[model samples]
Target: MKQRGGAYDPFDCKHYPEADVVMRPGMPLAMACTGEKARIVMLAGGRGMHQRLTSMGLGVGSEIEIIRRGSPGPFLIATGNTRLAIGAAMAHKIMVIPMEREIE
Candidate 1:
């Protein structure tokens, strides 16, 4: 709900509906899924935000991926290219979609 950047009112996203966010597979994510873990190839934020995100292991080139959504909610996530477990509360702060896997 909080818009990290000033491009839009921070409060606007709070009211934004889930359906509005685009979730095309392989496309860059516009927002975090309610219960899907998304691999974070990069993070978009300034200093303070960056620091906070880093605490959650969300940083540039970290490569966090969505595993699955929990029965209650928030979805299980894999963090870093290392692939650690993370909860949805932390994922919500991130705005991401999906990326097409690179062909080896």
Candidate 2:
């Protein structure tokens, strides 16, 4: 599917065009566009960080949306009913796969 950026890749979805571009795989959450939907692919932090995020329901495979992307500040993300304000450092450690989905 097509991500906010023009870079393209063939993802699992078949509904979108085969030529659709996706953001680079494993892009940091901090770089994700606001309102973009993505799935957690990997966590590039220590055990404590992993545990903390997992406890907050942000483990791998979790689907989330960017509510706010504040450069040099905390990023706000929504996963289900849970909203989290995460520091840029922490956000950078969270790798995600951008997804193309209708937001409704």
Candidate 3:
């Protein structure tokens, strides 16, 4: 079969869609883009009770997404089902998935 320009050919293992567009909004970004490893360093900030949410086992290292940004900006993170609301400031420091490869 013939393929268009740049489209991935699953059989060839040559094309990667993500390679072209690295980071994007409203989605989780790869750690490699941030130069951070599995262990990300971040500060706490968000809702007035953001610090309190930190202790809820949904901060740093956990996969999260930028749901929105504003005076009451909130994060829509997948921590089970509840949408975790993290302040934009804290989101800036808190990095997710480390780019380091796992050792065998």
Candidate 4:
């Protein structure tokens, strides 16, 4: 994956190279399924995008849950006690590592 600006730690994301990053370890938050929990790993945008996400309490390492999946409008996500409706376009700029659910 060709990220714009964000820290890339091998330990955090594993052995996927920059070119192949989009295939494994992490994926765009927009692609994540509803009800899934994910951790923000990278912001594939410039400083402005980073600042915007940060102001919304969404940054690297932040754990979030997908509340609603959106095909046209904004999608909803919950972080801590806050629920945010992020635009589809902005969601594409946020890369996340989807956490696997434990079998009960």
Candidate 5:
């Protein structure tokens, strides 16, 4: 049985091996093309950054659709019913697996 609010380590790919079996390997969010949908796999940042993103519903396992890709500006992404614009540098720290393909 799973414990609620226990030591949940979302970064452990072993616990979420289905992500790899169904989708491609992870890639930086900034590298994903515009209009692509992907699931967040990892976040490479400190506590504050994690809190900021989590507050905006961008934590690991969240599915996001890229609305626009900004090379030198903030990138627009849609998560749930909310749309967020994050800076390029920040987006680069988020690793995600594209959901555009599925393995049979």
Candidate 6:
């Protein structure tokens, strides 16, 4: 196939009328995209970590938005009207499913 400017398309891609890309399954909170909303799928941590997160309203099934995916520091997330900064390790322990739209 040829693209604009008369450049040959090596892949020979064909345009589809209603092609949609599906998102992958749940991923770690630390790897979630900033500004994206997701639901807590699971927490990989034990009692202590679980309690700590739950106290901050990040329990399982909670819907959260990634405010900042801190690589070397902490992950800033929002749940309800509260915003909390969780450590990188803790963020990695939280598994979340990215949502296409916010849940009410």
Candidate with the greatest lDDT versus the true structure: 4
Writing each residue's lDDT as its tens digit, candidate 6 over 1-104 gives: 55856885544545522222233336889889989999998888899999998788788899999998897888889998999999999888898988884355
- Please, what are the lDDT tens digits per residue for candidate 3 over residues 1-104? 24558674544444635543444222232222322324333433456435665666665445433334334444444454555555555555454444354234
Give model 2's TM-score versus the native structure: 0.71
Pairwise lDDT winner, candidates 1 and 5: 5
lDDT of 1 at 19: 46
Clashing pairs in 6: none
| Candidate number of the best TM-score | 4
Candidate 1's error at 39, in angstroms? Answer: 4.7
lDDT per prediction?
0.51, 0.84, 0.44, 0.85, 0.85, 0.81
Candidate 5, residues 1-104, lDDT tens digits: the string is: 24447865444556567554465448889999999999998887799999999898789889999999988889999998999998999888898988876344
Between candidates 1 and 4, which one is better according to lDDT?
4
TM-score, every prediction: 0.39, 0.71, 0.35, 0.73, 0.72, 0.71
- How far is 73's C-alpha from truth in model 2 (Å)? 1.7
Put down candidate 1 lDDT per residue, 2-87, tens digits, no spaces. 44554654335756555444432343333444345445554434677679767766665555556664445545566644544444
* lDDT pick, better of 1 and 6: 6
Name the lDDT of candidate 5.
Answer: 0.85
* Model 1: worst 10 consecutive residues (lDDT sum): 22-31
Q: Which stretches of candidate 5 lie over 4 Å from their true place?
A: 1-25, 102-104
